[model samples]
Target: MAKVSINLATGSIQKEEIIVGIDLGTTNSLVAFINPDKNPQVINDTGKGVLVPSVVHFGPAGEITVGNEAREYLVTDPQNTVFSVKRLLGRSYHDIENYKDFFSYKVIDDDSESLVKIKVGDKFYTPIELSSLILKELKARAEHALKTPVNRAVITVPAYFNDSQRQATRDAGKLAGLDVLRIVNEPTAASLAYGIGLNPEETKTIAVYDLGGGTFDVSILQIQNGIFEVLATNGNTFLGGDDFDSAIVDYWIEKNQLNKADIIADNKLAQKLRLKAEEAKRAFAYQSLVNDKIGDIWCTLDRNTFEQLILGKVQETITCCQNALKDAKIEVGQIDEVIMVGGSTRTALVKKMVAEFFGRPVHDEVNPDEVVALGAAIQADVLAGNRSDILLLDVTPLSLGIETMGGLMDVIIPRNSKVPTKAGRQYTTSIDGQVNMKIAVYQGERDLIKENRKLAEFDLKGIPSMPAGFPKVDINFLLNADGILKIQAIELRSGVKQEVEVKPTYGITDDQVEQMLLDSITHAKDDVSQRMLIEARVEGEQMVKQVEGFLRKNSDFVSIAEIADTTKYIDKLNAALTSGDKDAIHKAIDELNEFTRPFAERLMDQAISHAMKGKSIE
Candidate 1:
């Protein structure tokens, strides 16, 4: 029998889980949830405030700090602190080469089109890893405030974010141990927070003008029957409130007649001036003029001067708004509402300009910084089936996945995902010189592929031959409103692609699906155990192959005793694989990895030293 929990006071069945809403912004991030009073509220745990700075610091002893605590290290240890990491997500070094100077830390430039990585001390971190740290912090805070273990979430991203960026965000959430239910658009979330489109009869065209700390975007949305559709979006990922603070900094540098080169050279001095400039920008909200000092540096700015200095930057956003409307094929008069989001929109000139352009009063009553997150909470509520007024979304009947190594089902889209959704995950070749991959798709709720119904199978050809794990294959599943699933696989390095379509529910009765789901649940324990054993065997085989290949190619670098020890571990792993014991296989793999890691690092260090000396080792 299924178990249910009842609230003692209300004598009502309580929700089995709470799904929080997260706004993982470039400059700041926050989490929100539906409170017991049936209202969307942002969590403020221990009065640390609603906003968490998206900064990370790595200490010399390998400790890591995130959010407000990490923000303090920006000036003291600029080289080890990472900020504005969202800009690097899914981006190649070439994509941001022009804006490299904007970063205070080291961003590795390997002269390739692959994803960028940030170097902190001796360690390198991908944007996804850094982002996961921030998400983990938000998850901890939400759990503390709600007094519950929060695991699922609906994350909001900019409407302008591309597929790779969206996928990166999903991966980060997964790394942070959150099962992301939906990746909502920032503008849609903002609209929901304002109570728009809650009534089925309401129809409106709205513009969401968002200018946050490190990014800006203007989205034109059409809402009807509780459905929000984005008409057009345009903005620069690198332009936002941070640039406004920069404008003030530049003005102060010019007005004070200070040595520009010297200020730029002094990292601490530069950060202090930037902080003072931010303070002055905030003070301009109520005061006409402000004067401040950071040590020997003088910071003074009048409201008029600050406005003039940033006029061109703000006008650029207006031009983007114009372009968005043009693409949407709507005039300003057609807009029924103008919603302002982002803390930067608190600027007086920004409000005045947006209000005049839309020919409507802007909605700023809701806290601009928390609007996206609040809207996200409302969306989470809708997904939780707590709001009947909102339109119910159609969802997939069963999970869709591809058969991985070991005949295990690797789910790309989980069951009950809302329709018209697209999701993907990356895979790599397990064999050397792999030039093609066979993709077999399946649909069901089981953990093993043999128990699921096969939908279709296809081959992705023309993958460039490379060492195992060198070729990146991205498989995407696009399920439309009509229940048709279109699967596409692409080798990112070679641009080779293949696509196929299948109807997951065609000719399959509701009774069969119900039985399949019931059977999956009934045999869940046994199926999971078998699946784990198969997976462990596959992993052991892969590790054995990789280690053997490494020895064959680089045996000259290692001593005879080291080779003998490595061979012994490989033999033990092979024995475990034949034993059909998952725990034993895992233990062997762990021992092998731990034994090989030291020599691997030594080899890597030697290679780097040789490369730096303009030489290559055979």
Candidate 2:
């Protein structure tokens, strides 16, 4: 067995083994680590390139392939392939309903506020699960290249990602059998790779312009005393390199006099054109024109035309930079350095525009695609105590959470998170027409709230009565430098709100906090087990209530035999919940969901038909 050691002071695992850094991107993902020479290096196992395409494909026999191997299925089996899953992370059906057609695979539209799920064949998967597959591939690559068992990682996400998206990334890491040490911001990581924050005495303000395959963001950061603080972040998640390629495709279509709808309808032709567009985009770096052909289609584009096509998109990024600077309360002259990150930044137009906007030479010495992972590796090194000169900022002493279902502590602000931070998560009521919700705040490292210290409790009243999961309740935790915690709960639909203040450090001694941390680590396995069982039971109960409510409301739509079958599955789930077996509860829940889906979909179809009886299309 591998040796394990824990730091009593921080309650974190000691870094006796290598901890890799991962840049999980929308179009690609890669892993990096601190080499034996103490320099961060991206891992390229065998002859495979440093970048792995962020794609997953399920075979007919249920076998799954990720990365380069899976990229082939985009044209061959688009329905079975999943791409750009990062966009769906922590998102609900309502969040992505507008752009559902952008995806080739089936993204379930359950008309609920629950997290989005992707359907492949007969199996359902959340974005967290799909992302884990990509991470697993990265982990395997790292281990194969290093000739060691890698299990710890620091993953990087966009600076604009919210708390839910970050949490989803952490969960993806866990599911991939890796201990996610930290979720670092992509801009911060890129800055680290550029050696912008290594000096404690030298302070500088920098602008990081990141334009990746499917997203764009500009972040204003200040580095002082070895601390990297993000002053402001702004970006369009839907705008990126892909849009640039699409412009090329559009140009080609207009030139060839081909129908756009026909091209889209032919998946194979669309993929061919998209791939060719990407090739043409890359070719512009060395030449002024790219004249190519795919079968009968003519792919001819000049550098000037390409630039003109994407001029609007590049201008949009510059506008974001302007807004970021305004929000940071800084002028262009105040920016000491400008760093370029993401593969899209390699374009000459992007580089020129960004440099001109900053009124300074931009830093592009490091590979744009690999900078984030390299910087993350450097951060992992620092966390491993390999760098003594770098000092991390002050952080929260313990995890702060609210009591969720089954008395489980749903952490909002995790332990060791940098203070003066804000985080929030959306929750909903368990019962239909729940007008009030009790928000019980707790602080500790345990999974159960009863085992933690209760900070405060209050009720958020006056919520509008609606069906379960209809109300959007947002709970936010804001912790300041003085250790004062402010918890706010708000119902978005009804405008009902409640707020509470608690000094988390008021009564607890430092030694007591240390003891709690130690206990949490010591009982980590058991605590996880208990937490899992409780969560399963809670899910089972919710499923039962929803099924019962559905049957009561739509009795005329469902057959008697269907109701009896659903009741039978519900009874099985109830028994499983009582048995306190997590696996059994999951299995029962899955069976019921599978059985009920067909009829539920039929009911929905019928309801739509009935509602559209007198309606005419505009």
Candidate 3:
């Protein structure tokens, strides 16, 4: 029994290949698909739990494990076990500098601009690689359960994930050997699960409040003519049920008068307490009181106390909901539906507060944990050409970008973005007196241009000579209805402009595109490494030029000793750049910046004093 039909657009019979929907969650991930009966179903074949813990572990001998098997390593092998890799997706060491202590594993901090890497034993793994392991496990599970090769999927992400993060996710999927057909927003997918936007003739506005582990997002969406448009989205990427668990742990720690560091340092005790806190959180949902103990430590919590402990966090989410509504230019009364999605929504307090805020009954009919995956299945069905009632608008199948610093792919138009769209970002020259900027257009998801499909290269010449990072250039990508891309580069300060139009898909077969995507995934790690090295070299050269210029201009203001110390550091940096060690060059740069700080401050003070000499008092 299968829902098979012909796609009139292509005049070909569509085969039911069982494309799936995957909810790649931070805490837990799951897969679902539309069944033969045309109903969305979560696959939990042969008692394999519907929720797969998003955890991975590496052994002493480099053996790999994922999901439930890996969850055990959270306590036993905290350093080798990787959890919440989702948070590290497309993030740099600097992005999570403040939250480094939150993870027990080592997140390498060598470069701030390069993508994060987790060190397990002696091997380095990027977030993209770690996530691919999880996705691969999911893929294996699906193929085993469905008895078919599942190679295509629609994955869900937070609505606010920027272009880089989204591309990183798509690359992860590709690495997992799945063609990610679409990257659907979690809120939008959750809405689809509840059948809010399925009617082609109906129109409605809804609020989707998603609170999951390690993240919270509230998105206000307008569904019209079967198009789900996100009006506004607001929430903290770091605030969610994980915070609630921490609150519970802190409550117990304070009551027990135990040393906090003692627990975090002791991985077994930390994991035990974390598990107990999670149990207590779930128990309080049904029972008024819950008690638990791990050895000498006692953990107890009542519903009232637990609610009070997490009330502030809950209130924060409510405020985000209000802010989302405000940004959408809608009142609470304007929301036709309030849909709640996420395992955290199962908490009575969360549901009650969300209801109280919107002044309406919340939609919790579907399992919050499975809703996103189910909705994703429905979307997959639509993509499979099984549903004519749903309208899939035209979207760019691949991201288009221009080569940037270090030959990195700076995405100008991300994949799946609607057609007839225009987007732009401001960039600056990396070297002083750079008169010509080479813009090489490429199409793909990898971070480096070598892994992507290079379409064309051009030069924007006649730029005004200025100090490094002084000339502001605006780069824009405009995609028209005919599927042609128009890229425009303008130097606002110099009034120099250039434009190019390229048909991104011209003369390229689908098979060639697939090969390009495959190559990107196959070489992602190498490409990223090369990109980092090039970026380090570029940065080192720029720093050298800038320091030399600064010393020449400010020699009279700076002390001879300061100039000598800076010159020594600059020479060291120049030497390190030739060594091809990004870490060493960065270290030299930091040292130089530290040494010049005082001199730069004094110069700024002198300039301000001179400028104020003839100024009237306010």
Per-candidate clashes, comma-separated = 0, 0, 0
Worst 10 residues of 1 by lDDT: 5-14
The digit string of per-residue lDDT tens for model 3 on 368-484 reads 999999999999998888998878778887889888876788777877777888988778887778999998999987777777788888899999999867898999999999999
Best by lDDT: 2
Pairs that collide, model 3: none
By lDDT, highest first, what's the ranking? Answer: 2, 1, 3
**Which lDDT tens digits does candidate 1 get at residues 1-618?**
987765443345667678999999889999999877899999888898999999999999989999999999988888999999989997988999999998999886634455776767655567887998999999999988776778788999988877668767876776677767788899999999999878789999999999998888999999988778899999988888889988998888888888889998988888888888888888888999997787766787799999999888899999999999999999999999999999999999999888988888999999999999999998889888888777778988788989998888878887767899899989989888999899999998777899999999999999999997899999999999999999999999999999999999998999998798767756655765686678668767888887887789889888899999999999999999999877677678767877887877788998988778965668
Estimate the TM-score for candidate 3: 0.82
Better of 1 and 2 by lDDT: 2
TM-score of every prediction relative to native: 0.73, 0.79, 0.82
Residue 3 CA displacement from its true place in model 2, Å = 8.1
Residue 15 lDDT, candidate 2, scale 0-100 = 55
lDDT of each: 0.87, 0.88, 0.85
Candidate 2 off by > 4 Å: 1-15, 394-398, 419-429, 432-618
Candidate 2 or 3, higher TM-score?
3
Estimate candidate 3's alpha-carbon lDDT, on a 0 to 1 scale: 0.85
- lDDT (Cα) of model 2: 0.88
The regions of model 3 sitting more than 4 angstroms off are 1-14, 45-48, 110-114, 254-266, 405-409, 444-456, 492-495, 509-618
> Highest TM-score, which number?
3
